[model samples]
Target: MNTQALGVEYYLAGMRAALDDLPPNEVAEIMEDVEAHVAELSTELGENETLEQRLGSPEQYAQELRQAAGYPPRTERLPVTTKKQLVTRPRVAAWGLAIATAVTLLAGTAVLRQSAILLLPAVLLVLSLALVHDRGPAQQEIMDLPETRKIQQWLTPEEGTPGERALTYLKSLQPAWWLARAGLLGLGAVLLASRDILGFLFIAGIAVLSVFAGPRAKVDRRWLWFSLPASALAIGLLFQVIDVTANNLAYSSSRQVYQPPAMQSYENIYAYDENGKLLTNVLLYDQDGNPINAPRQYYGCNGDDPQPMIPANRYPRPKIDYENGSCYTVAPSVVAPSSTESAPPSSSGSAPSNSVAPTSVSPSK
Candidate 1:
């Protein structure tokens, strides 16, 4: 073999590695065409382009090949497909993009509802995804292509344990699952940032690890166990943080007034002036100081002389008849009465007292 053939052989090897995630037979089928293409390219060396220049890197070329074969981009290598477990699967990237667009639109609408203009981007993303995976009669449909089914049949396993079955199911929907996972992670990051930057960064780091783990999950699905829990934890913490932050914000924005003791009833209570002094013989007046003789409907209580109702548990309770003016007290003056109005002063120089015999007050139930 000459130098050109050796180079072609190396190139083919790289291509094979790039496609290693796929089933062996599929890779072999692809290489046959690649070998022919390389041979043809070698003869056209004088056409102002080297093979590498014309075709680009092997990994990139492999991505193009995968897409051309009606598969998703080679972002990660999945478990190898086989002959026995035949199945059909959708193009992973298309469905992934479709689901991601939907999730982003929902999240964006929730976070950015105040800015109607921002909704345009989300709408456009949804429409584009719809167009890409569209199965309607109006446009060219790629999802139902025969090659997609053949590839799925090659990937599925015939018999498996519960874990293996679950893994197989996941592998079928892997692309969309990852995208949905990423979308949830992004929402978590946003929520975390709303409360704490450090928390958001921590969750972001975990998310990065989970993303990298996607490719290797085909080898050992232990990564899924770790990643799923980590994701759940991050999301839970983020939601908690956001909830606390929202509550705090709401509390801070309002005025904090002191609450009185629970038993201090204000029902049927007397009103007082700001200085804690009682208003006596009070008369109703409007802002213009005009006498307002409104009907009882305007004011729930009647008299200018207001009296407080006795506590519900008080013994010998006041007969408070609502229809008539009972259990009411009216004070003639705000100050103590003059000495001249009272009975003749006691023989002693001291003022007389109006005390009555002590009576026991019963405790409230």
Candidate 2:
């Protein structure tokens, strides 16, 4: 190739690399337009005038095209020597702080559950936000970062590679993930609020905001301020829910025997007859002929002198104030018992006339 042709080819190669992030078809069309333009310019160039003198560097040319086409400005890859210098840039530092804050907040709140450790991330987040606001226009600087490019290259690997396939699969699931994130956020809110309606609504609003902001944040960095914190809180709440569920399951499994629902709260059983008279020494049984048991081993007292009552189906047990050395009988109403009679044994399977049924009373009541 002649000198002019070689210059054109070299320019196009540089422009191609600059626009690597664009779609292949779009890149091809852009290259064709630039090639035709450069050919015309090469013909008009004097002997000593180069394409770089006429059109500036290929990176600069590509940037002009991007601006004209209403595309975001591309970040040209910098050499390894300049990477350290770029890391100290305010925009790059802000992004680094933002990432560190997110990771620390998530780990501290959800995994570590340590409030003392969370102060650092909180301060970092505030500093990150301040830097982002002050630095202005961080998207280009962030994209130009060495770490960012490495991540992009890793995610967008060579075709047919396992990384590429995995990336493709993950990209396909993006819509589903977006929906799941909102749902999970709402669920976490509900769990954290103990199923309160107001809490659900508040988190649900944040979830909705996140769903919309998540996509926009890719193009617009400002949305990060809202989206990041909301996501962190959602993830923390989800972990909290998981921890609570696991604890409940462990507690339930530790108990060898199941306690009946009716006996869960009440410790003593009381029996009453049809005439509103209290019945004493009444034995109770279930339909299956099983003795209905009470919850506690001792009853009828409140202190160290608690009366040891045998575990039986007896009802209308006396209430005793051990401190006062007094035992008192309880009735359903002001009416006294007709007599101190031992009622006949009763079964839940069949109700007999004058058969007194055992009733449970909670300790608080």
Candidate 3:
């Protein structure tokens, strides 16, 4: 290769490594621009003049490019001692709290039925906020540390790997997740508020705040204190709703399986004769020749003194208070009998006088 060609290749190689942390498309564009600029400069170079003399080192050129592009300055790799000092105790504690918060939040979701589990994540989140506050301006330095940069790089997805693809997919879903988080927070507010209108409005306002905070937190790390806890609470509420819904469905299924259709909501049966006089001890039977007894075990006046009645095929049963040894008839409503009601002749060919029989019955609770 010619001297100029070798110089260009060496410069390009160093530039590529220096800009490795940038997006691939951005790096490619930068390289193209630099290559063209170098070619133009080479034609104007005098004898004994080198590319390094005109453009400085490749790292310096890359730095100027980053500044022109409005990208943050590239962080250089730190020596072992500097790296150790950069990983301050406060930063380490803050990261630990963050991890603990995530773990507890996930565990809380798994055991949403046990609401107490939510407390741990909440406590961890508080600790994280406190640590961030204590770190103050130094927090920025901690974030810029080599270890932190390495973690960020690892988290950023690259092409052609399953884990990377998964991470990319998750990142793509962030906007949708933000909206869902708001909805979850609103739903949780409704549940916690129950019937209190003012309380629901107050909590719903927080959910609305989350809607704005969620997107803002992505661009500004300072918003994380509010966004992180809000998101965790929203997740907890979502899982709690799921847990409650599941339990209710299970209970409803069991009730449907075990309870007889006719006996549901049944409390008492009232019988009346044609003259509107309440009937007593009126026997009841089904078309299949089976006796229809009361479904529940106990009946009483106003449910004050409940006492079991002997299971039998009888309507208009009396309420017995065993404690006071008293019996009273349950008269829910009165109905007038038809004026044309008449008795049929007896077996002896004589009509009975003033004889009545229950003609209809109704159940009530």
Best by lDDT: 3
The Cα error of candidate 1 at residue 236, in Å, is 6.4
Candidate 3 global lDDT: 0.61
Kindly state the number of residue pairs that clash in model 2. 0
Candidate 1 lDDT over residue span 1-365, tens digit each: 23333366567667877886665446655766787798788787764555676687777788888887896556554435421224322233334344444443444334322323324433544454444332222111222335544655555546676756876787788766555656666666566576666646755665667676666545433243334444444354445547667989877765355443345221111224555444433455569966543111112234643354223222112222233532233222222323433432232211111211111111121
Per residue, candidate 3 scores C-alpha lDDT tens digits across 1-365 of 23455476577767867886775456656765676788898789888887878897888888888898898778664434544575565566557556765765575364323434545665666766665554332244345546776887899757789989999889899888889988987876666565655546655875899889877866555467667766776776777678888999999999988965453343345555666456767888889988887644333235454444555567655433233433333333333343325432222222111121111122334
lDDT value for model 1: 0.47
lDDT string, candidate 2, 132-177, tens digits: 4533333434554567667777778999999889989998886676
- Reference-based TM-score, model 1: 0.27
List the lowest-lDDT window of 10 residues for candidate 1.
Answer: 351-360
- TM values, all candidates: 0.27, 0.46, 0.45
- Tell me the deviation in Å of residue 36 in model 1: 21
Q: Which of the predicted structures, 1 or 3, would earn the higher TM-score when compared with the native?
A: 3
Q: State each model's CA lDDT, in order.
A: 0.47, 0.60, 0.61
Indicate the TM-score of model 2: 0.46
